[model samples]
Target: FMNYVPDMQKNHFAKEPIMTPPSEVFVTQTIYADANGTFHFSLLKAGQWGFAALGIGEQKTYKGKALSQDAVIWVQATKLP
Candidate 1:
């Protein structure tokens, strides 16, 4: 299970479709806010299903750094046949 916390203050866009099947499982990316209020994008899922959450404000930290300081976002996915 993957716990993905996002920043709500910042807009988030999924590269792939939200609802998908197990075989059609695809990877998606979530962009974070940049220094100028912009967002830096990235890829996720890779090819799987689980759950996630999204909100405003910086919640968790990663690699000795804060995930976000404006908002937070969460996402959840499931693999079906």
Candidate 2:
């Protein structure tokens, strides 16, 4: 559990205002994708869910160092009435 940490100068889109960072963050779990590049998680609660795909892109290096083309997608779920 910690406050949101902004990306460093190494980020490719450090200047873009795509979205605002959360005030606080918590990592509930970390799961890796399978050989087929897929993962699954059971939504046990009804709220916003964030799926972060880290280092899953073809571009893997920058300035002779490793880089990550990370992505995030949020989903909202509702229980059946």
Candidate 3:
């Protein structure tokens, strides 16, 4: 187990206790997409869950290549089937 060390920067910006960072902040599993660029995940026992995705890519144009960052998306979990 890792202990949380207080930080002035975070505490000042957040204006909250420089406390527990996050317990469930990391991914427990990774599901890779298939050749169809499609993938999925199972929630096991239905309950509220949260998910976030980040993607980056580069494209070539007539001039040069362009780099970009995809919009961050967060999906709140609901009852699952």
Candidate 4:
């Protein structure tokens, strides 16, 4: 089973992109970077998963920008390991 949150809102304008859980579990992480310089990270477990997107705009303007536009996300699962 999988739970997804589409069209999420941006919280703090300057927060690093990271995902945590209520408890630790085995997971596989995959990262994708587009030609536009945007990055997407996904975490997959046994039956649960989550994702984070980052837009490191311009590749030159790096001053006070949010590492992540959305709020920190957390996923929990028992079958992770």
Per residue, candidate 3 scores C-alpha lDDT tens digits across 1-81 of: 112334676673333433443555533445566666566866543333444333533443335655454443334455645
Worst 10 residues of 2 by lDDT: 17-26
Residue 53 of model 2, lDDT score: 82
Q: What TM-score does candidate 3 reach?
A: 0.33
> Could you give me the TM-score of model 1 versus the true structure?
0.21
Q: How well does each candidate superpose onto the true structure, as a TM-score?
A: 0.21, 0.52, 0.33, 0.24
User: lDDT at 61 for candidate 3?
Assistant: 39
lDDT of 2 by residue, 9-74 (tens): 665434543344443233456868898868888765555677888778898899999998988877
**lDDT, candidate 4, 29-72, per-residue tens:** 44665776466544344444555544433353447653434423
lDDT of 1 by residue, 8-49 (tens): 667654445444535533333454554675554333444333
Error of 3 at 26 (Å): 5.1
Ranking by TM-score: 2, 3, 4, 1
User: Candidate 3 at residue 55, lDDT?
Assistant: 54
Clashing pairs in 2: none
Candidate that beats the other on TM-score, 1 or 3, i.e. the better one: 3
Q: Tell me the deviation in Å of residue 45 in model 1.
A: 3.7
Find the 10 residues in a row with the least total lDDT in model 3. 45-54
RMSD of 2: 9.1
